[model samples]
Target: MPNSSPPVTTEAAPSEQPVIRWTEAGEERSALWRSERGAPPPKRVVLADDTTTADTAYRQACEGTALLWRGDFHNARQLLQALARRADNVPARKRKKAAQVVPVADAFHQHRLAQSQRARMLGMLLIPFNADYSIPLRRAPDVKTACTEAWGPADAAAGASVASLRELLGITSAHEWRRKGVEIAALGEPPHNRIHPHYGVFSPVRGEYIQLVATAHLPKPPPGQTSLMAFDVGTGTGVLSAVLARRGVRQIVATDQDPRALACARENLAQLGVADQVQVVQADLFPEGQASLVVCNPPWLPARPSSPIERAVYDEGGRMLQGFLKGLTAHLAPKGEGWLILSNLAEHLGLRSRAELLEAFERNGLRVISRIDAKPQHPKASDASDPLADARSREVTSLWRLAAIQ
Candidate 1:
């Protein structure tokens, strides 16, 4: 069942009572309302009951009003469902009449805009949480661990209050994922070595990219040499690092800026028994020094992240990609290779171009040694209901092997 608890209001009393009113039957029920001293009374309020649709509650929330749900716990969930349907039902804007279809750039922008709007609308539904991480309203189960995992413990002085329903749902989902763990076979081993990703850490749901890393031909052994060190940059959950370690790399340096990702990678690597072979480090992109092989699986999309959590999926303004390209040469041992695992989904969406990537490589004095591509097998690739299915259906993930031009 959907969680449908309204956010708890924390209005404080002001110097005097402010107006408290509700409109019904073309009449207003007025009462004096006071908040804590110097604090303001709630500007608006709405009643929540089993009969109230999530849409109605959301509408009130959008208007800066709160819904005090008096409905059954389960009924609130149904209302949330109604609200979601309404939010998703908006017709997409008609394309401008032109012989040429909308450019991928414009389509990408519009897609992001629509996504932002949908998120905004859905976020209006609020969920209240107590200091003990309990849902105070009836039928509210304990969500303390979930909330703590996401928000880093509750603030008691701040008092029990409400938060966006969307955020609450996300936290709850993260909790479940953390507990159960996502099974990833990309490491290509027995059950004991599987990767378990944490919340906010990008899961390698798309197997194509991981396959690219796992199958790409490693650089030839040095003259009379049999071993080389490899680095996996931004190694979320250490999937790529484990893949490299399994592929016979003598040593692997895996680095990431996110603490959660670093921790997740460490745990997964340890589980895989490759911790001794792979050294996990906290670095923005590349760790100090060069390596015989440097690989990075950066966020494929080049756009601003709407929230901090989206960083795993969105690379704002292509900063990470650009940083990788610009810094690859400095981190590559002479004759060594840099394997960039990327998706062409951004190009399909019109967010970036093939030429731009090629140009970046050239400008960095890096030449494509070889390119290997694989088609995405995710269900979304075949999901016709997805607004961008047409583009997704044609998406390809690739491993771009690069060598310094020098």
Candidate 2:
């Protein structure tokens, strides 16, 4: 097995105190014990091996402790899994059952309750970091850049703490994504072929919207006229813009407000060789000029985002959707079309209605030209045991092609 021991460093010993040293499985570790007035002596101990479960470590941590592992790195991973399973097995408060029956609303509430409990349980795992973004323990690699990307670069002598095993996993996944980009096949053939998505930018996991944009019928240009221009609002990873550019659009404007998303989009567009064709700008939705085509694939759910990553999944107050519907007409060229790709999961959840959506478009001076629908093919669609399987089975993603009411 390869050595996974993290790089180590020595610190200055505390004055006026004797540092206590101990040996565990051939490895030496040291810590300073201090007595404050009538306080008990600090319980300084170390882990026997990497097989130590996080739950055990967590219990020790609550008692003011630390762990020094001696086993293989892979065994530590198994221990973490065991800790996770234990955490998940913990039961939550039972809900009151109605005398008559459970309604659809009750089912939704129950689902949300279970989700909240799961989040709370998984959030107990805490990870520590040093001022310079280093984990101060054995076998810990330098995570400076990863921490910087997620939490910004640390100030001089400043350190922060983060909890939640879910978030830690997210950061770890983000690090891997930053190192190895997500592959995007939305971009078509020839000049524009590939898009490498960065960490913060939303990955193109749902292929339905991209397929709609790629296969949609485009209008022909008149004689002596150049190719049409299209705008990809919220061009996360610049995937949509690259797809448009590959679809024979003469010029493309990709707009986004998030700095991270903008940077991610720029890199992806550049790598896909569509940077010249697609001009990425930091705008909330539309730029100054009008385009023959406009595309938007906003968050499908009308729910609150608990964290930054959830922003890609939840749209608060439907701001992005409303903004696109309201400002789209002013930025669309004559005879232009606006493609709105959205999922109807919110409808099944009783959050929004189809009538309300149609009314919103009518009030915004836009009318639906046509719609293309696709059924979700994700594994969750077939997972009958999933809590949201009932809703997922009825979910459908639609590409609502719209045009300004003449």
Of the candidates shown, which would achieve the greatest TM-score relative to the real structure? 1
Tens digit of per-residue lDDT, candidate 1, span 256-369: 998888888998888888899999999989999988899998888988887756787789889999999999999987678999988899988888889999999999899998
What is the C-alpha local distance difference test score of each model?
Answer: 0.73, 0.68
CA shift of 252, model 1, Å: 1.6
Write one digit per residue (lDDT tens) for candidate 2, span 1-406.
1122222332324554333343434675454322111122223444435545566655653444433344553454455566557645534444234223465556766777767554544443334455566665566556678667766667654333322334545666777776676554556553345455555667777777787788888755534567888889988878888788777787888999888889988887778777899888999888988888889999887777655556778898898999999999998888888999999888887778999899999999999889999998878878997767788999999999999999
How much does candidate 1 score in TM-score? 0.83
Best by lDDT: 1
Root-mean-square deviation per candidate: 6.9, 9.0
The count of backbone overlaps in candidate 2 is 2
Pairs clashing within candidate 2 = 6-139, 47-68
Q: Candidate 1 lDDT (Cα, whole model)?
A: 0.73
lDDT of 1 at 17: 35
